[model samples]
Target chain A: MAFTKGAGPHQRGLTIGVDIGGTKVAAGVVTPAGRVLARVRTETPHKSKSPKVVEDTIAGVVEELRRDYTVGAVGVGAAGFVDDQRATVLFAPHLAWRNEPLRDALKARLDLPVVVENDANAAAWAEMCAGAGRNADDVIVVNLGTGIGGAVVIGGVLRRGRHGLGGEFGHMTIVPDGHRCECGNRGCWEQYASGNALTREARELTQAESPVARGLAQAVGGDPALITGPLVTELAQKGDRACAELLEDAGTWLGIGLANLAAAFDPELFIIGGGVSEAGDLLLEPARKAFRRTLTGRGYRPEAEIVAAALGNEAGLIGAADLARDALPRWRQGRRQRRLSRSRESRRAF
Target chain B: MAFTKGAGPHQRGLTIGVDIGGTKVAAGVVTPAGRVLARVRTETPHKSKSPKVVEDTIAGVVEELRRDYTVGAVGVGAAGFVDDQRATVLFAPHLAWRNEPLRDALKARLDLPVVVENDANAAAWAEMCAGAGRNADDVIVVNLGTGIGGAVVIGGVLRRGRHGLGGEFGHMTIVPDGHRCECGNRGCWEQYASGNALTREARELTQAESPVARGLAQAVGGDPALITGPLVTELAQKGDRACAELLEDAGTWLGIGLANLAAAFDPELFIIGGGVSEAGDLLLEPARKAFRRTLTGRGYRPEAEIVAAALGNEAGLIGAADLARDALPRWRQGRRQRRLSRSRESRRAF
Candidate 1:
């Protein structure tokens, strides 16, 4: 609350960062160094499921944290497509944000400058600025949550493509006719490599009463529906062979997906984040092996290093705050120009 | 050779561009407007199977074109990876050049500033500057020849990633275990969607003696091994049903690969060039269809236009020349700094 460790009077002011997911709203007052000074969390209020309700929930969290610190700006990392200007949410699958003007609404309600970004992009920027990708000029972040999301950082700048919809790596087809995806595409990379893929595969194995999943089924109380990604990860961490094998299978697919990304981006490093990445080498080793095998020009070209995310779950909030803080100077420059132009109008009237 | 019509005297001097493939060497004297002032072609001297033999052939073509035009610089677009400095050929699959210092060799041999570039990159740049992607801020070029090759142009500059290898779209895996690729990967997009794929499919049909391939086999004089990509293209152009269907299938795969690229890059336009691209609408319509169907966030996001290359084969040569001409200023800057540093060294000696 008192600015993590040290806060001199001359120090730069803090900014609030909000990570809005489907189930939770995690907000924090972040320092310029990406330290979370104070934080508040709340259920997403999905029962209301309205844009106003969501904004009010986010505002409530900001209000609680701002009381403990002097804040400069607010940045929200939303699980949706943010406009090129970072002013609106084009669409979010779990939120009632269909082309919602969330930024303007929040700015008006809180009387603070606001900037919004795609959640994955915010996380990637956080890694580049403060986490594993620090000092790396070109990096790609593949966040393997229930779905796979990605962000590209080139020359240390976040690349939001032509329409602010670049990093949708999960949906890239990996097995042309392989598995059906919620995105309505068949054989999406996420369908085979993400947390959902692991849970689905495990669930199917248990449902079919496969011998390999005997221990997993027992841990899930004999209910195939009770199987979850985290349960499988926990089981794998505890040295469960079936769960480990499942992770390895998913890891192989993940590696192939990474190879495809490498073919296009040729980044120096890849940062793996999201929920499933918690499996660690249990998931990455197989991926790396497959990547080496599948990478084009395997022996000739340099391969990108694949590593886990350093900021963990806090990356989104931290990145959001920093992005807002970075945009502050430009926003102020714009305000000054408007004020100067207004004064010129007044002088002309005189 | 004279400048193209309307090129004023104050315009930049012409430069020579050479497109060196495994089988042919195409060279041109190009003006600042991306117009070819003069051109010459010769068979590649792969009989000697030496890098120097290839260089001498390139030099022979450049020397021939230079005699007719007053050139400023020379640019060679080789079918390989060009280093970040644009001064070395890191590796070429077709030519016997592995980490060859072709630029310095050419500069020494010709006494002119020389720049080497990846052929796909050169073609993409040409399209951006003068062809299909003219005035477009962001563009992706997919060249579907013997295999697929790609380049990304963001803003106005070509993007060469961390190690000067970014746009090898042909190698991106579209199907997990669909087909074996020459790069040793299975189910690469090129394996399913390139000219080789088309020719292979047609050849297979003829080899198996399918009734649909009757016309194609007859066109190839009943020799399945005689089937080439152009032969299939020509048959399709003449309204051959089986040949048309093969192109359509390959186009669909091409479209899927393009969708994967869109997910990563989000370029505003995609220019499809290369030898197989000559199939025109016969190839593009199906690709566009598959692209629309497989594209992530299909209805919500703006789709990139997939079109044909207007400059055709000359794009490589013209773009190479333009790249060399552009590098001339920077090359001169380095020389000037060297001269100034040498003077300071003499001063230190005194």
Candidate 2:
């Protein structure tokens, strides 16, 4: 096995990064540290949705960017799960792929190296590398979009868990017998904290003609259907009572869920991202207050800072590229086979 | 800082282990691989009454055991919340130790190398070293005793959270508006799946004169006060319907709780210990079944093995001593005051 040296003036000054979203395929040429040198995007074709075409689209984007900048190995970050090998998109919810050999196929077709990874994991890494989580050894990312997303990095190494299916922060059971979750569970943390859930709560409040809904009703033209996550965040920023309450509710739930996560995984910082986080202090102020209130041993331990994600939408691409740059010898997401050491004990404390 | 080597020929013969329980203190000389050599027991004395007298009583038991065997370093597992320094007991519900420097105090008094640890973490380490969790890198210990005790081991090392409060599994809310817990939280995991809960449910069944409570009432002589976690387990083993049903209910909840932990930490093995674990397969069978049913990704990943714990009562002492054998470096648990490494740029993954 050969190891490629990272970030040297040896060859090119650019690395190819691919961000495979639910609706579009975006690719960019990233600098050694993390700046986007050049970007190219294309509509994700809706053909047989042949996994082949998806690979081709990624190659096409990289190919176009390479024409403008000298690109090295490629990194692709997709919405669904990526296998441990860091070269396969094992399953994608919005994309048509099942146990698909993405990186290997791309490597074979393009004669260039490639790696694939989960979008959230990639995004978190990007934040750590050059964004909000920089200089932190332990960091957590909570993406509050359509659904909530979570990722953890401990001692600077991303904890991929036993299987790639490790960091499902959205699915944590927060409310018992409260709301039915999509994953066949009841009252998941996401059901109470995600952007979709925020909209749901806002709609309910508007339908009931609550006292705080007047400002929100004026913005949405008296239609409850107009109350979306983005609109609510907009109204909250403008100091609408109903919108502020919805954001506060989201923040409180987010805080409690985060505290629970902190109890399990002792992270030092949390980077909040996604569409819902655009309200900034409107969402963050309540999140910070409630996190302290619900935290175990509240005043004892050093608290994890809850901050906004710095890299914004570009994290997934950068993280994917970085993951590819450091693929393990036998790396498969769930099947990370380590040489089982028989207790060669060390007093390595944490 | 000096560290002890892994158990080799040196610790093969015998090492004294001490468990400071709520009601009693148990001590014994144990072999490296986990067999008790010479054992002694005494009632756990109250400190308010006479803290020095209680210390003297502990010393008497230690001296009694020392007379029969060549013991190595001593390990004491206390039932309480330990501090990050590992030398102090912050707060113990059953014992009178508030910010008390336990290890150093005991070491000075006993004139023996002493190590002190939280009882649950110690029990977990004992299980990993000599019991059900052998050869596992990540493990979770669920002790279903009076309340609930939890311990998490990641990469074969005990994961002490930011405040030395990593495994507070018992306190996580399983139900938002359920029963009130002793910790001032409602519907904690302990409230539904522990020895106390088991006994409560069994006693209720017997009092209700239900079909499953027939054997339980007979065993307890139709007296509700006679019902206990152990008696219920015993009756369940004897094929009693009501008692068995109660254990099964508790075990199913245990499985659900275990599943939640598994989802959060992604451990490869779960070792179930404590007094209630004595119910054996009568409880474990149901727990295993429920865990499989409720696990997040049922058919996606490798299922974690749920098994019984080893070391029995002496596990806590053995594990604590073993932890002491490998001394904790002060820096491991503290924030490093160092800047970014000069070699970090070179170590970057492009």
> Among these predicted structures, which one has the highest TM-score?
1
RMSD of each: 8.2, 7.3
Q: List the residue pairs that clash in candidate 1.
A: none
lDDT per residue as tens, model 2, A165-223: 55667777777666877667777788998988999999888889887788777778889
DockQ of each: 0.37, 0.31
Model 1 lDDT at residue A51: 85
C-alpha lDDT (0 to 100) for residue A51 of candidate 2: 81
Candidate 1 lDDT over B1-350, as tens digits, reads 34557653334567889998878889988876677878899997774488888888989999998776677889999888777778888888887788899999999999999989899999888887778877576789999989999897664557777777889889998876678998888888888888899989999999999999999889878999999999999999999999999999999998988898898888789999999999999999999999999998888788999999988888899889877875576543211112223323422111
Model 1: residue A300 alpha-carbon error in angstroms: 0.8
TM-score per model over all chains: 0.92, 0.85
TM-score of 2: 0.85
Candidate 2's DockQ is 0.31
Report how far off residue A258 is in candidate 1 (Å): 0.6
Q: Candidate 1: misplaced stretches above 4 Å?
A: A1-3, A8-10, A330-350, B1-3, B6-11, B330-350
Where model 2 places Cα greater than 4 Å from the true spot, the runs are A1-14, A42-48, A209-211, A298-303, A328-347, B1-14, B47-60, B68-72, B207-214, B328-350
